[model samples]
Target: MRSPHWKRRLRVVAEFVLLYGALLGADWLVTGGSGFVTLSPNPYGLPILVMALAYGTEAGLVAAMLSTAVWLSHGEQVAPTGDYLERLLGLSLTPLMWFVMATAIGEVTNIRTRSLRRLRRDRQAAAGDAARLDRAYQDLVDANRALQVRLAIDTASPGRVIALAAAAISAPIDQRRTALRDLLTAATRTDDFTCYRVEPDQTARVWLRGTAAGARPVVLPKAFVHQLDRAADPLSVTTAEDRPLLADIGVAAAALRGADGTIMGCLVIHRTGFATMGSHSSAELAEIATWLPQVLDLGAQPVAPAASRAGRG
Candidate 1:
């Protein structure tokens, strides 16, 4: 409405055309399309209301003024010569009253429209703020969880396996499995753990902690390898429905990868909650997986996270 002055000008012109056309039709009816029209049942009334609703009070006032002129001009042509003055003077108040009514209604309509628009704008702003607050609240919860995990890990050791895993991120390719074995052994609560090496030909080789060559060349189920092959991100499955393969060896796992994030293998953990772990064991394990990926992408030495205790706030 504010921009492009030409459009507003065009609207003003169109409003006037409609007002005058209606006034002419009304005049034709009163005058029988011959003499002149009487100023009863003002045709400008509808036009004035329309202009008010569309473009506000200023538009309505202009329309009212134009109607008043047409009415006065027609009154002269239609009235009888003698004693016409009295009749004209008697009906003089009609135009003034119509103008007043138009102005009053226009202002009222404009005011209500503005109020409704303002209400809508205010509601939209409030919704936007609510969305931001909700997002911030979630972020706060995650931060608090991370803080709790770090605090627990700092208080008591999760064993040398965790420490070695932390160090192994910077270690050479072959040694990462060695460090992972220690961590998964402590974490899985089982001694018969086997690390799998998925090959390019959809085949896999299983390795124990100290064993180099395998007596049993275990071919992974095609369905399981296909699923793991599709996974590009670290996944920890606890629920039964998550993976078809976890039903065989792993109940929950953190997928392992090479320095380039290629799916090398998985550090298979046991069920959701079965480690020689602290109270917040799930959060601690998550923290371990997040901070120590297959290979860390950092230029600086990793500092111990979250020393101070986090609060409910």
Candidate 2:
């Protein structure tokens, strides 16, 4: 296929040929003879000016060359009355005028075309940049609104878990255990939940062993720990598979994970009201477990030392 550059060149050449052919035909009708009529100003000026204004410097120069050829041909038909140099100088003036006018007007046309193209490009670029900025601003606004909603939910609840969690996060490393204990107690609304922290060797140590006055805390079974380890979220007594495993252990339970997604602890609620044990309550407990590592020291020593009376449940 022909490139655009070659196509444009061929079109320009064809236009010049057609223009000069029309001029030749007009000259023949006017003079009826070989030579041009001795008119004061030649008729070629109008056509050259039109070409220059329309197509810029290069096209104007091509037109000028074609006009000059026609002018010289007409001069050749004139009577040989003077010396060679004198005849040449007399014929040179009209051709010179055509070239000068074509160059000046054509140069101005080229400048205007370039300026308009540059302005169009700049405007398009500015529009694209503005659209990108608007999208970024909209994303930030959406994120801020989501954070506000989360804050409202946290503050509106009766538990005040957020306040206790904040206290745990800001408390001294030595005092973090007490803050975490308080946070969990308020979050669950019961003191009958057992908290166990997992050690590096995968041994579950009692962090806070909550026990009813006369009831002994049941020891966590291997099957229950295995289920909790595999669970992605918290498990509740309502779940069919978990219902059997959690029957004697608790109403709801969850595995506490660290930042790197490693299981760091386990929480088992040995007792809670029947009305407070459901999917929503389990989700709330799971959400609290999700942020435990961020606010509490998971690696600290156990809160309770004796596993005998509670049986490490």
Candidate 3:
């Protein structure tokens, strides 16, 4: 596409040269030998103007020079001059005037061309910047959507905890510890914690334990049983003095209750080191505690005395 425009410009330049050459040749032939004529406007000035407009100042200057040369050659034929001043002024000044005019015209054309090119470049740069901004905005939108999805998952129903409670009740006394193990594993999927099933007799016993490397589990005191029985809702203790017995145990605690509003056992979730539970984790545990009694009731069944003793052991 660009090639054709350049070719057209080249053709215009060729035409200018051909026309100027022909006008000069015609004037030379008309002068009939002496090559001089009376001072008058050259007939080819129009062609010089046309050349300047079409192909810029250089072509126009070439055309003007040709016209001046043709006029001088004819003027000398008409009237021979021996005066050096007259001859010099006549020959030199005419071409110089034409050259100046042509140069001025060409500079104007160049200025306009440069201005247009700069404008085009500026527009292209602006468009590229706008596209880059659009891409960045889309990336931000995608990140926000992913964050929303994670929030939804974290806030979803507490069905899994309820299901675990159901399984525990149906399980034989021997298998009760195994059920507690599974529950603890699920709860500690995010952090390492120990699980203790505080029985109805006020004895605090470790049911399932999980520990991270270089960490030890702190045993809960029998005093915690009386506290668990008295608490109406899921409770958390984090102080080093109030619950000094759990001073070594870093973070939070939650209780699991039965259908008759009795404290079946307390599920103690400990967050050691930097690990801690968020509002969502606490809410999930409370929801699970609410459904525990119903789920256990559904799974209630007779237990063999030997199997019961095996479970406690």
Predicted structure 1, TM vs. truth:
0.42
Once superposed on the true structure, which residue ranges of model 1 sit more than 4 Å away at CA? 1-6, 25-39, 77-88, 144-313
Residues 81-170 of candidate 1 have per-residue lDDT tens digits of 658677776446666776787788889888988998999889999999999999999999999999888766642346555666666665
Best by TM-score, which number?
2
lDDT by residue (tens digit), candidate 3, 1-313? 1469878878877897787666657757875433334435555666667777666777777778776766665565533576877777767675676677777776676677678779989988999999999999999999999877765564222455445656776789788756755654554443355555555566655545654412544446666656555554444553334365445653556555544444555556665333334545556556555544343321243212110111111
Clashing pairs in 2: none
Query: What TM-score number comes out for model 2?
Result: 0.48
lDDT, residue 191, model 2: 69
Question: If the candidates were sorted by their lDDT against the true structure, best first, what order would they fall in?
Answer: 2, 3, 1
Candidate 1's clash total is 0
* lDDT (0 to 1) per candidate: 0.57, 0.71, 0.57
Q: List the lowest-lDDT window of 10 residues for candidate 2.
A: 304-313
Cand. 3 TM to true fold: 0.43
lDDT of prediction 1: 0.57
